[model samples]
Target chain A: MKVLVADDEPQIRRALKVGLERHGYKVVEAADGEEALDVFAEQSPNVVILDLAMPRLDGLGVCRELRGWSQVPIIILSVRGRDDDKIGALDLGADDYLTKPFSIEELLARMRAVLRRVEAGQASEPTAVTVGELTIDFARRTVTRGGTELHLTPLEFDILRYLALNPDRVLTHRQLLTRVWGDEYAEDSHTLRVHISNLRAKIEPDPMRPRYLRTEPRVGYRFLSGRS
Target chain B: MPTTRCVYSYAVALAGVAAMTAALAALESVRHIANDSMLYLLVVIGVAVRYGSGPSVAASIASFLAFDWFFVQPHHGFTVSDPAEWLALVLFLCTAITVGQLTAMLRSRAEEAGQREMEAAALAEASWSVASQLDLDHALRVVLDRVVQISGAGDATLLGEKAGAHQVLAQVGDALDPAEHGLLVLPLGAGERIGYLVLRLPPGRELSMAERRAVNSLALHAGVVLERDRLMRVEAQTQALHEADRLKTALLSMVSHDFRSPLAAIKASAGSLMAPGEPLDEDTQSELLSGIITAVDRLNRMVENVLALSRLEAGAWRPMVEPTPVEEVVASALEPLSAESSARVEVSLEPGLGEVPVDPVQMAQVLYNLVENALRYSPPRAPVEVRAWRGYGSFVFEVADRGPGLPLGSETHLFEPFWRGPGLGESARAGVGLGLALCRGLVEAHGGEITALRRQGGGTVFRVELRREVGR
Candidate 1:
């Protein structure tokens, strides 16, 4: 796999290049957003790791330009306390985000997750999906946990089905609401919270420390497929 | 000078003399009354009290001629027959003139006193408005209203001049065109004109001499008010700049001491590994690497704390409140700690303590900073306790540590930024002393309270109480 790293900081780019190269992945580099686009078109990398702040054009601008014609997975790198910028990048069709000061291992996990999501989108939907001990049978519209059938309301079942299908990708409140409850209910996050809380109670062994459905706080929710 | 008023007063005096003469003639024909001419004094006194000295002098001379012509021995003429009668007539004329002049003098003095009283009342109202109202435009509007009432102007405006441009500060009634001719413009201030009080009066009307004096004094009062407002603003700006300077000095000293130590440690560790001496053993090499990592972590934490403090002080961050489970808040707080440090913490929570309306991100940050502080100060092998419960319609939590207790009388100072406890040795873990201050700012922003108290059996407990329902 080839990864394109774009950042204004020379030290960060050098560190990431050295780290990702040791993992046996081909790495391409760009010092700013405008160059990142040129390099991306030339190299056609499989994954792009973009920083939010850069010279000439920002990561959001690059994300918007790339999304206009391509579906290549893009992960955003942002500093902490910049939640609005992160959400804006996500809304503009970026795949995922990682706050800065993250470990190399954390960045690798996010990269793997976004790559898996892109691969899954190209393939046909699976009838049955299993993560940990929980099994979701899309064909039969049934969910079973630890070999015992768990009863779920139809609305709850639809919410779980939508999240389970998108496995490791983060689904914002607008995305989930429009898909499960229709576009008219896209802004009603409070209702989504109530149902998700109820669903977590029935699915997870420990609702306090969720293993599958995780909150992104002020952003949205993500379904961890117990992969990374 | 209004000639119409002077003419009207003389006409009234003429009418009074005619009426009195007719009355005296009728009385003389009915019965020969002694000293009938003395009755003409009534008309003189009436005119004097009503019309002042101008018309009363005319009435006194007119009354003397009428009495001689109609009631004296020489009828219809100013001639007297007997010498004694002539002396009596002369005495009567002298008495009428003296009484008329005295009554007119008293009346004029009374009118002057009333005019002064009215001017004083208006001035007192203007001064009160200027002193009480802090809003310059509003106060000036009140002053302009009084100017209109006293000067009888159709409209009034207070105009401030700056760099040869006139700007209307306050206006009462219709807006005035500054370019209009014949406006009663009064320059304000004692020596140099700072502004102009422009009054537009009704066509063909002008202010009385007394009204003009009152208006000028009012304009001066407005000038003084404008000067006072400018001085107050300058004083406030100076105070703000002084406070900012003090904070900057504190931050500089803190950065020099706290930031240097971690940088020095990192440099030493990295330098030793890079030295071209004998190759170090594996254990020593790993130790140096770990040392570098530890120093980097310390520097990162310090940077985060400083950034958070500045953001809080600048009011750039506000809690994005939502309904969140307390359990989720606790989990996120513990997620950042190392496994070994996490093992040292013992958690206890009230059963079924459900969700709360709060900014989960900020609340988690508050708890994390408190726990980290507790873990750092705790003695080796001593368990730090984290407890949460709902009480008194509020959600309360505390982090307790079996470490050195707080110094006496330093409870309040503990939460102030850059305040470090005394007697901490070099071996003790050092922090930039911003964690607790950031916690206080976040908690208070949530409409909550945070406090630190000495725990029993030699430790300190930091407690946070948050409102269960935050207002949107």
Candidate 2:
């Protein structure tokens, strides 16, 4: 994998380049946001990690311009670590965000996750997600519990599919809202909650004490498989 | 000059007697002379009320002479032929002079009362108008308006001293040159003159006693208002200084306590790594290297926290909102954790969990801080569970660690900056206690809230709630 690390800090750029290269990835470096765009066009790196603050054409601008044409996974690195900076990059279609003083391992993992999601989008392959007695067939857009067909609204089915795909992992309300209802509806956690309860009523043995679709108080919900 | 003024008074007195005698002569042709003396007394009283005691006394004496000359049988100069006529003239003279004196005294007293009432009304009205205005300039203007009205002056100007020179704050009527002479300038305020109230009267006109009194009262009212406004401004400035002082104290404490430890650690570790001679073993060197990195990281974190706190207090941090997936934020936050720490964190993300409109970077920082705090407080193998879900119209994130729960009564101050729990072990007191405070600041910046609770299974659970946007 070829990864481009664009940062104004020499230490960070050098460290990331050395560290990522050691992990069997070709590393490209840019001193600023403008240079990052130039290097990105010329080298056509597989992934790009951008720094928010740059001398000219900051990270948000670059992210916006890149997202216009290529759906390349873009990760932002911000020293300020303010919400606005992160949200600006994300809203402009950057794939992920990381604050400064971040570990190289975390940056690589985010890059991988973004790239994998892109690959998954391109493959267009359907898969079956089975958790406990509930099974979701992505290809057929069907869900069954214990070999019996369970009727579900399309919204409920989508919520379940997303939860089942990432079993045992906690998803935030915002994540669910954006994925299911698009980015514009990302803040509508109430709608997500209602749908989640409805999904639980259908799949969970007891809606009050959900087994498959479990509520993680103050967070979101987690789909815990029977095995872990 | 004195005799001439007396002659004018006697002339007025003679005119009153002559008019009265002519009228009595016409009445004598038909009516009896019983009330003739009483008619002369009426003329005496009228002269006393209109003019003063000098003219009235002269008129009373003149009427007696006219009565003796025209009506008494001996119609000559001032001689009385009968003794009865002499007695009647004496009684008439005594009664007329006494009535004239009494009438004059009552007239002066009534005029004094009228003047006092007018002054009191003007003072009351001026105070009401000035008190209604909260702004100093506006109050001065109202006072100037009152000044012109009450003084009957052609114009009025209020001058405030600035840099040793008077500047006009408010003016009414014709524009008067600032250099114009003969202005009725009264100094306003109690001690040092805050301003001057200048009134220009009409040409050759003088203010009455009541008008002069009204002007003085209005000036006093204006001074009181101006003084109050100055005090309020000084009070606001003092309040701002106090707030700045408080921030400085907080910063000093933070620097003294939080900033020093990491610097000391980094210095010691770097010194060992760069030491001369046989060079340490590979294991020892790597350990020292990691130590150096950890120390630097801690220092960086402290700087970021301090900056964040200042930014929050300054109200400079504005959240850039976007649709952020909670799981993505949690995952990103966990990315920096060591392998052992990562293993200890048990993340249970609700599937199909949608996005929330928030500043994801701030939210991620909140998650990172909570998780990091949990790691520090708990044993290496003890599990820390991070969970997220939707509740009502909000998204919730909770970081629960199986560590010693917060000390009793410490939960309330958990999110306060630099607040450390008492009776903590040395290892538990490893951080500067800014993590939770920064998390609170970041979360609140997005219109969210953060709180802490004791877990039922003996741990501390920090919960964050971000309100969901309704109807997009």
Candidate 3:
């Protein structure tokens, strides 16, 4: 994955470039707002990391400029961890943001998430399906293992269908609740986890070490298919 | 020679009187040989004109003797032969004396009246000096000057009471030590002195009566001016205090409103985020973070604006003005926010535009705030324009965007603190608006003005104008 980091402070730019590149993404750097624009135009990076403060241009200005022509996923790095800024950036078309002094692990995770969403939009076919110790029929919603039938609840079926629909994509707990249980249940991570545990118990050969459903710590859960 | 000349003039007068008496005696001798009245009446009129009232009585008695000897009955014998002639002689002498004295008194009274008229004219001309000057200080100076001219004192100073102590207010010529110039204090009570008069220590024994009266009059007039001036000052101070009180009330309400809105948003957003699940997808998690950052940015700008106000009051910060480039300024202000917003920012500096004279750091701050303000208002899908151009000998940097135009009347009040417009309050993602106020301060520090204009079709434009630094 290609990522762009825009920051006026060389230290922050250098640090983010090192951290993001260490996560196996190709990194391009801009020292100031002017260079950030030039670099963005040249590189067409898959993901852009920006600082709110910069010399030639600010992160907000850069965000605004990029949003005009492109719907590319953008992540803002802000020291100001206020709701207004988040809303401002999101409303302006930024994909996500990371406040300064963030853990490198979190940055890598967000980077992964945005790329997955971008990649998901262009994906064409449903790849594969598996249940218990058997292959499944995706079009007809049936699963068998060892030549025996497996019973799945209607709610469980719906959850499996969503997971399969967004295979290898990290879905935050809130996203999962909203998509599956509706908007009112978006905040109920406990409910989401219980449902996920139940789904794993029914579908996984070893529920403790699930192969399909992966837990992304401190952020969300992801569904990784056999292709990975 | 002096004795002969005195005698000759008196002798000439005596000769004319004696001749008149002889002629009257001849006429009376023809008409009535015993009448002496005509001769006596002639002598009385002559004495009134010649000697005045006191000397005139002596002249009248002498004339009576002349008449008895020359013009009475039994001429040239000093006796009137008839009893009727003797009675006439005595009556004529008494009437002559009284008439002479009355005529002399009237002439002298007319002369005394003329002298009094001259004194009134001199006094009127002197007091004219006081009436012409209106300023209290000027008037007092004129009064003192007139006193010096009128009373012939060599020098003058007007001393006034301020807070119950005397201070020399206005002086003309050889300013005197309070102790040196023999001062006459007349404190203006209902009937007392509230002021003092100083006069030159004239090389003389003591003050004349006229000098004392002139000093007393000056003190009375000065007290009127001093009291009037004091009253006017008190009234001015009261008016200023009332205006300050009004401003304070306005400030308090605005501060309350400004602080409450963003704080509410922050609290509400935090409350929402506290729930266990990420209600918004991975994308929405990012959205929530962006909102929080925006709110915090608003709060920071507000705090900076308030701090700037306090600093202005205490004179803690004074701008060190110099020439600065617009492009550089834009970069410095935006550098931090670009990363924070995660948005693309566009910056274009007008070519051939000269540097503006301003404090470099403050100019940067001004640019930062305007860009930030525009960013908050504009859509993230739109490119925020930070454009600098030269117009009419002034350099202007404008942060323009395709956002909702400023609310009615808000274009003018936009730079006022806490002025969240209808456009801002309408936004679910709005912030407390102190950014514009801080921009105003930074611009004004460089002797320029900042204005927010609603663009013709759509969008808000913040225009900052600065005078170009000369010869650069």
List the candidate numbers ranked by TM-score, top first. 1, 2, 3
Report the lDDT tens digits of candidate 1 across residue range B1-472.
3677779989999889989889888887888888877777788888888988878888888888888787777787778888898888789879988988999999878877777777788789988888889998877887888888888898888888655877888888776766789898888797777888988988767776677778888898888887788789889889868866766775786677777787888899889999998999999899998888887877788788878877877678888788877777776677678878877888888988878777888888899899899988888778988899998889998999998879998788889877766765332254426888899999998999999999998999999998888897
User: DockQ, per-model, please?
Assistant: 0.36, 0.08, 0.01
How high is the DockQ of candidate 2? 0.08
Q: State which candidate has the highest TM-score.
A: 1
How does chain A of every candidate compare to the true chain A by TM-score? 0.96, 0.70, 0.59
Regions of model 2 farther than 4 Å from truth:
A1-4, A24-28, A33-46, A64-71, A125-228, B1-243, B246-250, B270-301, B311-472
- Lowest summed lDDT over 10 consecutive residues: which window, candidate 2 chain B? B423-432
Clashing pairs in 1: none
Model 3 lDDT per residue over A28-77, tens place: 99887778889989999988888777777777788889999988888888
Candidate 2: lDDT of A2?
91
Could you give the interface RMSD of candidate 2 in angstroms? 11.0
lDDT of 2 by residue, A1-228 (tens): 898888888998899988898889999999887898899999999989898888898888889889988888888887654556666676577766666678877677676666766776686554887777888899899989899999999999889888776565456667788899999998776677667756766887644235677554334666766542
Candidate ranking under DockQ, highest first, comes to: 1, 2, 3
Tens digits of per-residue lDDT, candidate 2, B180-269, equal 788888878668888878888877667777677778878877777777877888998898788668767766776777677777777888
Q: In model 2, what is the error at residue A116, expressed in angstroms? A: 2.9
lDDT ranking from best candidate downward: 1, 2, 3
Residue A216, model 3, lDDT: 41
Fraction of native Cα contacts reproduced by each candidate: 0.21, 0.07, 0.00
